[model samples]
Target: MSDWKTLFHKDQFRFIDHTNSIEPVTALDAFAVDDALALSVEKGASPTTMRIWTHDQTVVLGIPDARLPFIKEGVSWLNQQGYQAVVRNSGGLAVVLDKGVMNITLLFADGNKIGIHEGYQMMVGFIQELFADYTDQIKAFEVKGSYCPGDYDLSIDGKKFAGISQRRVKNGVAVQIYLSIEADNQARAKLIESFYKLGLQGEKSKFAYPTVEPNTMEALATLLNKPLTIDFVKNRIREKLTDLTKELQQNDLTAIEKEMYQKRKQQMIVRNKKALGDLFHE
Candidate 1:
């Protein structure tokens, strides 16, 4: 694994924690926030930033997922099961996000010079270091039967606990990850499995959806055999950031970023409407 410090060495790191905010911020807002942060970092208005966010019941889908044969029915099923579905502006298949799932995004400048694989490696290295005390068995490889399977899937003992995705805006890159810290991961996998089943309806499509096996996914609390909570993981992240950089400062969105967020959020709204059509709702 690449040393995280070598990849992300900086004098200061800005931290934004929205995990326990009283204000309601949906997954749509979360993605928009990342876009605004990316632009800010790219323009040198913001430093390297580490943001933590979580949402309630939401299924974030990829562009191709919206094209599934019976997508309307699939989305209806998700709604029936008390989950709202939205297509994200990033690259990846459908992923389940709930209160139990903690999302972390690292945004920094110089995206033009960073190779795609290096962006992924930076996240992998950071995750490994975060849990180094518990175990050194975290490995990054494609977990074939898991939702949003990718080359940067974080797993232990053959069971995946997290997945990573990347989004680049102008000269900045945001490496995003969803960690199944403490929840029924099997149930989460099963939810996606049923979604695909309904969406495909036994019909063939160019995109090959994974044959999701619920047993292939496990939560970090279960995999580590420790009672882990979102708060615990957040603290670990803060400690790691402090150790990696000379200073860690808590910052809020500036006026420019807030304005950018509104524009990005509107784009997200329009994108979802076009992608989901009648199925899209606030």
Candidate 2:
């Protein structure tokens, strides 16, 4: 585990908590925000940032997912199920997002300085700190049957509760994680399972999708056997980061960042349009 103290040895840390905001910030917008903040940090105009955001009933898909055999049918199924699906600009497969799930993006100044696993270890260490009181058994290993399965999947015992992925823009890196704070994790997993079933339809493909098992994934509330809400987890993040930094202040985007965000967001929209084909306009 990389030491948070060593990785983030700054005097000040910028905080942006969008947990309770009523603004129309989509998951697409969140990626743009990270990109803009990352570039600002790379230019030495902004401090390393900790951003918390959540989207209501959205399924964030990866690039490969859009290439599934019958992705259009899968996407239509998602729409019929009342979930808005969008492809993320980051590396990962499909992940569920809702009020019950909390996303944390730790933006640092440079990507080249850190190895990929080191970036993941930073988040793993931070999460271990967050749940220090509850348990120390949180493990990081690939959970094979879990959605977005990766080596950095944070688990307790055998069930996965969170997964980490990293994205780099220019010299900046955003280490992002989606923590399943509450609700039925199996329900979320089942959605993805069905998506692959419809999309793949037993057809042969170059890429192999996971044979999702809902039991392999769980929420913090279920895994920890405690009432863990998104608000509660947000507080834990703030408390832990506050203890490590000399100063932690909430900061919004600057005018330049906002402009950059608009451009990135448009790019995302265009990418989605291209990737989803007819599904994009719908």
Candidate 3:
């Protein structure tokens, strides 16, 4: 195992479930919620929360993704395909987000001793362990034809089912990742590949993106050879949460967190526009 972040070993194990809810939210709000929950954990007000959120027909792009030569054309293509496009202040390139995807945001406070790789390693370990009963062949490798391919992309036999990204704020870290739990993986890949073609426009760019091949990506159901649903993944997460901690709580946002969510939500609106404008500068 890699050197996992030690700053959060003592934090409580927590879980929050928003199962099958359609939330048309920004990544900024997600980051803010992560920060607040992490602070709450640091203060011992709550357990280390595992938050799950879902969005429908939205395209979340990375910062570098915004700089594509023909981003406007790419975005226009997405809108025509009925997908909302927004920029996420995080790593990775373009990814198609929708109702069928399950996003898990793990919030915790890592003390001074934590490094970036260690933080990511912790989540990687958790996912592998959670699915240990099913199989141990889940490896971290860049899925060449998958949308949002990364070093931590989780796949079964080279077909990616999930991608992980991280954000750090004030000693609190939000290791966020999205699992294509259930969806039309082919359609999702085609959408992103089109976006890349339109955005890149056969022009040279500083950052090299994957030449996406839609056939190479798949859903958890198809990969697992079973009728896997979001409910199954949710339950699996709950099962893992129970085993990792002594106590698990089912709860809602606190007063402070509510206020922060609203404030940071407005910031999200600004971020979305700023990101688009930066990419599609007139």
Candidate 4:
């Protein structure tokens, strides 16, 4: 059990609470953060940041998702449900994001001492401490039926509530996770399963997508038998981070960050255009 203090250390985490708005930093916001932090680390302008963001009714697809045999059909299905679809610049498959879902990205600069497991463990440890009051027996294991299933999927008992993905750029690593603190997890799962069906249309393609099983998906509320919300999870993060370190500075995108963000935003636009072609052709 690594201590939270050791993981975050005594540095200032450029934090942002999305519960309050400022230019609407969506999940794609981190595509910029990743680039900015990677540069900041190279120039030594700032310390690591733990940015928190939340998006409502958005379908974040993975690169593989964009390559789905019938991606146009799948994306169209999502749009019909009033869910905006965008392929992220990170790994992993399709994931459902909503107000009830909160995303946490820990931007860190490792001078080569931190390995992959170490960075991931820090988050796992933080979640354990955050939800300490709920259950102490949480485990990090791959949940097969999970949408973005990974080895470090956060689970209590047998159901998953969160999944983490890592992207390393230069010396900085942005570890991002989408936690379903609250919401109808089964409904979310069903959405992606439908997406796979529509995206593939039973057509044999070179790419393979997960056959999502809704039964394997469960929200933190269902796992803990308590009504939960993103606010609850945000509060948990604040308490843990604040308690671990003497200073807690929750911040928004600074001028420097904004400058860098704009560039990455354009990059995202180009990437999206490639990933999601004009559905008008559909």
Q: Which candidate leads the pack in lDDT?
A: 1
TM-score leaderboard ranking: 1, 2, 4, 3
lDDT of 2 by residue, 1-282 (tens): 257666656788888898887643788888888888888888888888889999988999999999999999999999899999888899999999998999999988767777777878888888898898999999999998999999999999889989998998888989999999897999999999999999999999999788899999999898889998988888888888888888887878889988988898899899899889778742
- Residue 47 in model 2: shift from native, Å? 0.7
Per-residue C-alpha lDDT of model 1 across residues 65-96, encoded as one tens digit per residue: 99999999999999999999988988999999
lDDT tens per residue, model 4, 174-209:
788888888688999999999998988888877667
Off by over 4 Å in 4: 1-4, 280-282
Pairs with steric clashes in candidate 1 = none
Q: What ranges in model 1 sit over 4 Å off?
A: 1-3
Each prediction's RMSD to truth: 1.3, 1.3, 3.0, 2.5
Candidate 1 vs candidate 3: the TM-score winner is: 1
TM-scores of the models, in the order given: 0.97, 0.97, 0.89, 0.92
The residue pairs found clashing in candidate 3 are none
- Stretches > 4 Å off in candidate 3: 1-11, 21-28, 42-44, 278-282
lDDT for each residue of candidate 3 in 6-82, tens digit (9 for 90 to 100): 32344356687765543324545555666667667666677667888877787888888877888888888888887
User: Candidate 2: worst 10 consecutive residues by lDDT?
Assistant: 1-10
Ranking by lDDT: 1, 2, 4, 3
